[model samples]
Target: MQTIMYGIPNCDTIKKAKKWLDDNNIPFLFHDYRKDGLDSNLISQLYQTLSWDELLNKRSTSYRALTDQQKESLNEKSASLLFIEFPTLIKRPLVIHQGVAIIGFNQKNYQTFFAV
Candidate 1:
């Protein structure tokens, strides 16, 4: 199975997800969005499966720091632009398998979805 995990290494959720995958002997690649740039196309694709509200991290300081105009006027295009500019603005540990884009990591969700 071709799986790609995207997140910052220091994130606890990412750490736990990585550990879970490791324990299950799941082979996957890690994509550090902070190091490697996030693709606009990938973000757009993710948007198709997950809404901007789901993919975008509204809780992060990066998102919170946005001006009122940016926050209020947020659309798919604007959200995608923010994600490309600040990967940290994305929710942690997005996992991709086949054409499936998994948003946030959850123990039950991971188990059911990834079968790990």
Candidate 2:
């Protein structure tokens, strides 16, 4: 299956996910949002597959740093804007495999999804 992993390079979860993929001999492309810049269309596509609440990294420092109004008023459009402006607000290691969008890393999930 064709796979693409998206995230900032320095994210620890991303590092672990990459290592796991490598160890499992999975050949996939890595898209560094920080370097490549996230397209609004791509963000919208992902949002369609996974809702804003699912894709957004609420636990991230970026999310935590948001104002009360921003947090309380977050909707699809606003959240999309935030993600575009600050890629870090999106969850790390968003893996798209065989047209499936998997947000965040979980060893068991990867094992089940990839059948590795």
Candidate 3:
């Protein structure tokens, strides 16, 4: 499978990751969730491979805005649905490299992931 990075287009981390991939001569497909839309299958796959704590972006404004009730009631299924409903709640630039789900970006992690 082709490497794909999923996130909002304007995200800084996404921008950095994109630039890093390009700089490294790594070819990848960028999927903008806000423009291209999100799907349950991807979310489900991520949920299965990783923990909810890894998948959810608790630091995002979208997640921070969640009501205490909503936050308290969140579970795997509910969090999955919430991520689908508001893709911003999901972590930035979820990089799918060689069919593996990577939740965030950093130079070291990218280097390790790609062995660059």
Candidate 4:
């Protein structure tokens, strides 16, 4: 199966998820959005599966620090653009395995999806 992992390299959650995949011998392509940056098309697909509410990390300073107008002007296209511009604004460790996109990594979900 072709699997792709997207997240910042130094994120603790992403570290744990990557370790889990490594330990389970699951082969995956790691896309460090913070470094390599985000793919807008992929981000759009994620927006379809999970709402912008779940995809955008409102907790991040990037999101919180946006001006009220910037926040209000964030439509689907703008949201995706913002995420590509600010990868940290998106949730961590978004795993794409066998065409299925997993937003946040959970042990049980990972186990079931990867068949570990």
Best by lDDT: 2
Ranking by TM-score: 2, 3, 1, 4
lDDT of 2 by residue, 1-116 (tens): 67999999999999999999999999999999978879789888787678988888989999999999999999999998999899999988899998888878899999998997
Task: Kindly give the stretch of ten consecutive residues in candidate 2 with the minimal lDDT sum.
Answer: 42-51
The TM-score that candidate 2 achieves is 0.94
Give residue 52's lDDT in candidate 2 (0 to 100): 88
Highest TM-score scorer: 2
RMSD (CA, angstroms), candidate 3: 1.3
Model 4 lDDT vs. the true structure?
0.83
Backbone clash pairs for candidate 1 read none
Predicted candidate 3 versus true structure: per-residue lDDT over 1-116, tens digit per residue: 79988899898999999999999999999988878877888777776667777888999999999999999999988898898898999888888888688777889989999999
Q: In model 3, which residue pairs have backbone atoms overlapping below 3 Å?
A: none
Clashing pairs in 2: none
lDDT-wise, the better of 1 and 3 is: 3
Which lDDT values do the candidates have, in the order given? 0.85, 0.90, 0.87, 0.83
Local accuracy of candidate 1 as per-residue lDDT tens digits, 1-116:
58889889999999999999998888999988878768888787677667887888888989888999999999988888889888888888888887688877788998998875
Q: Estimated TM-score per prediction?
A: 0.88, 0.94, 0.92, 0.85
Count clashes in each candidate, considering only residues at least 3 apart in sequence or on different chains. Answer: 0, 0, 0, 0
